[model samples]
Target chain A: MKVLVTVKEVAEVDDEFQISGLDVDDGSLEYDLNEWDDYAVEEAVQLSEADDDVEVVTVTIGPERAEETIRMALAKGADRAVRVWDDNLADAGFLDVDTKAALLAAVAEAEAPDIVFSGVQAGDDANGATGVALAERLGFEWAAVVNDFELDRDADVASVRRELEGGVEELTDVELPAVFTIQTGINEPRYASLRGIRQAQRKELEVRTIDDVGLDESVLESPVDRTDMYEPASEGDATYWEGSPEETAGELAAFLRDEGVVSS
Target chain B: MSVLAVAEHRRGEVRDVSYELVTAGRRLADGLGGELNLLVVGGDVDGFAEDLNRDGVDTVYTVDDGEEFNHGIHAAAIERLHADLEPTALVAPNSVDGLDYAPAVAQRLDVPLVTDVIDFEVDGGGIEVTREQYGGKVETTYQVDADQYAVTVRPAEWPQAEDRGDAAVEPIDVDVGGESGTTVNGFEEVGGGDVDITEADVLVSIGRGIEEAENLPLVEELADTLGATLSSSRPIVDNEWLPKNRQVGQSGKVVTPDVYIAIGISGAVQHVAGMKGADTIVAINTDPNAPIYDIADYGIVDDLFDVVPALIEEFGGDPPEV
Candidate 1:
């Protein structure tokens, strides 16, 4: 079965950003593949390496520079890469999850892979919506925040364990050709080897646009728009301790005991 | 116009975030000069919704489908109800379950979607949603058209709504095609070395204090005494004193434990970023000026070697023989 993995490139925003536009400040701003997407690429590549018939493909939606991220995935083991950059999308200024999902869905329709993988969320947008929305658009079964899963090739099914709040986890069985969002720490992402890196530069990288993908111009419109941004509110006023070690320990224990955090 | 909030529940009990949603939703609806309607789904949701109206909600819409947080059911049902009502805004939690289907519902309606919202405001003609990225290092606010939108609310933002007398309850059945796509086989609770720090309830996390790998047993003993999982800050993990999984920092795991005891940790910004969500923070440090104390609920200005023994003694927990 063919596995398609979705990746994203995000700006490593420094503390200083352009205040007038809430954009990254002009400096040594580094652009890298999203932190969470590393796990997705690793999972897909691991699946491909373990099976003889499985092939892994990586896709992203960004400017021309995003091909570096695709190459990063290829170095990890993705067979090929696809990048979608439409002039309309570029002109939209900002993008909401739906617009990104639309572009991703177009790529998925073009690839028509048997399964898809995406990072649980992006470090920049942190929307956590694209994978699920893309799945909905593709009419594929889906699971979110998955830490572990086993694809039953014979049964045409997958059993996935999802990470939930408060440390709870649930395992479910999903039919194949499904979308699974890979959570961070799900796997140890392998660093790109020298040989792998050299080979990735020679791999297939497909470039497409909205018109090329048969997507409508309306797909460029973001339902959610960013109007303004600023710093978050500061922390609450904290009471500091000025006592000796024993006194502070005693006081802290008492406080915690009263708070019911430490019953003893 | 009305604001629709998805009342999230697990098993048969309503998650506290549901009430928080109602509280936030009530304010949003009032700002728009509209009503607040909550959607409750599941098989025995009638019981969960019975007291849901005690708060700021104007109406609680119940769908007793007998399923517990099914992604397919909620997505399909939400899409159906959204199309039927055409509410001004739809809100759910930015949780595993909430994010699973909220986007699909929004996409199905072709409404603007936002996720992981920390806070929001109703502006002149639309709503401005604020969400933190880069681990709260940067905050971005988005403006969505007021006429239609769907978004997920982050947990623990607004206080749980208090009783506001009895509001009306409305039962609505929706026809969402069977399962959206998958079926649950079962769940496996963490019991062993899977030791996902993110899943621990109480974490006895150490840092540079233990000093040497030989001193680990001290913290391990204390962890056993408190029945807490053992973890540490990035320094220990970087030094290979602890595994990466045991590290609690930005590059490590983001944990929201009920109680986090930082032993000898200085609380760097990146380190504090991962533990900021903890319900209660206890920092034990020799330096009173440590940054951890700023966010810690309780601070003990003491050396870990001196204070940990006292703590173990106070709890009457026997430390393993050194």
Candidate 2:
């Protein structure tokens, strides 16, 4: 089974972030591999380690700077990396998620992997649309927000559990060749071993342009318009209770009871 | 012209957010000078379909095929429904199931899809939706350039639509089968078997200030006395003091209870992202400078050790069930 994992690099903003036009201020922002995609790469590497025949491949769609992120995935054990970039996409600065999914699906079609794994959503957009949409565009079965996953390689079926609202879970058997969007805590992502990092420097990392992926310029057009972005309205107008801990607790209970949250 | 609201139901009951979607749908439909129509997809869901027939919707379309939410069936059913109705807008919950299928339906129809919409409006014969960005730190409003769209509304943003007698239910039969070819086996419960805090009206949540694993029962006593569920921040769950299911944060679960009593939680952005929707927030922290104070309606700048016991006593001296 050939396993393909999709990874993205996102900004890590610890301090206040400023919106500069259609994007955030990248001055203090440090771009690293997305937290969720790290888990996807780790899952693929672990699956490949279990069986020597399972070849692990990593793919991404970003600027040339993202190749460093691809290397990070390879250092954790992916056999190879593929990056998709185009002047049309970079010139637009931001591409609609649909176009990105279309381009990624095209890449997936070219690879034709038996199983694909993508982070449920990227931190930058947090739209959570790309993976499932790519699956649809590629005609692959999909499961989203998966937590506990088990694969029966012989049956080409995966018996997995998905995280749902109110802590409810759904267990399903997905027939491969399928796409699975991974949730956090599904696995503890492994770090790059010293030896693996050395091998990653020598690993195959290929780049493909939009023309190479068989997608046209029409799909690359920006569809959504960002009219404005600003800090969320400040909400700190709170009344601090100043009294003994006992008195404060009693008052708090009374307040909540009045709010009809606690029955008195 | 009409806006289609997709009602979500599970375990034979329609969710509260489904009604909220109707309320949101009504606003958009009114703006578009159209009516609101509801669509429910599931098997043995005649009751849920009837229950979804509220006053706001012009018609309730029920597609009885899958027992639970199957992504393929939802996409195919919505596609077929859109083909016939051609509603100007489609509204659904920005939920796990909705996120999985809404974009697919949007893709099939070749329309722009937007998720996690906190506010929306029909402006000058076009659509404008506002959603959070960078983990709710920023809210961006966009002008969606599309004649029709699939929008997933964030929960707890609007009040639930009041039921003013049931509307006429128009159950429609359509093939749930689609070319995507995915199957539903079954759903089982995972994580620690605890009361789902997401469903609770009141939640007593703790954080690193709870200090140690041994003192968890103190919070439990407060929760039990108030008839609230016991929940915690990621630190407590990371320390294994509580199960992952009860952890409230971006990585954990999103919950919007009526009252969230945050004890000893500093209110990190990630944690706040999950529970920011609570109607009233009462935070107990030793530091008045805690970030939790920003969003909190009330705050007690005192030690939780003293306050929790008094709160538990205020609810009367009933021993904690735990």
In terms of lDDT, the best-performing candidate is: 2
Tens-digit lDDT string for candidate 2 (A119-156): 98877668888888888888888888887779898898
Chain A TM-score values, per prediction = 0.87, 0.88
TM-scores for chain B, in order?
A: 0.70, 0.73
After the best TM-score superposition of candidate 2, give how far the Cα of residue B266 lies from its true spot, in angstroms. Answer: 7.7
Each model's lDDT comes to 0.79, 0.82
| DockQ per candidate | 0.40, 0.47
The iRMS of model 1 comes to 6.5
Over 4 Å off in model 2, which ranges? A239-264, B178-180, B193-230, B234-241, B249-294, B298-322
Fnat, model 1, is 0.55
lDDT of 2 by residue, B1-322 (tens): 6899898988878988899988899999999999888889986667887677777878888888868898888887888889898998989888888887887788788888887898987887569889877656567888887778778898777889877745677777877654445666676554556457789889999998989888888888778778889999876875567887898976577889988989999886568868999988989998665668889999999998888887888878544432
Best by TM-score: 2
* Candidate 2 global TM-score: 0.83
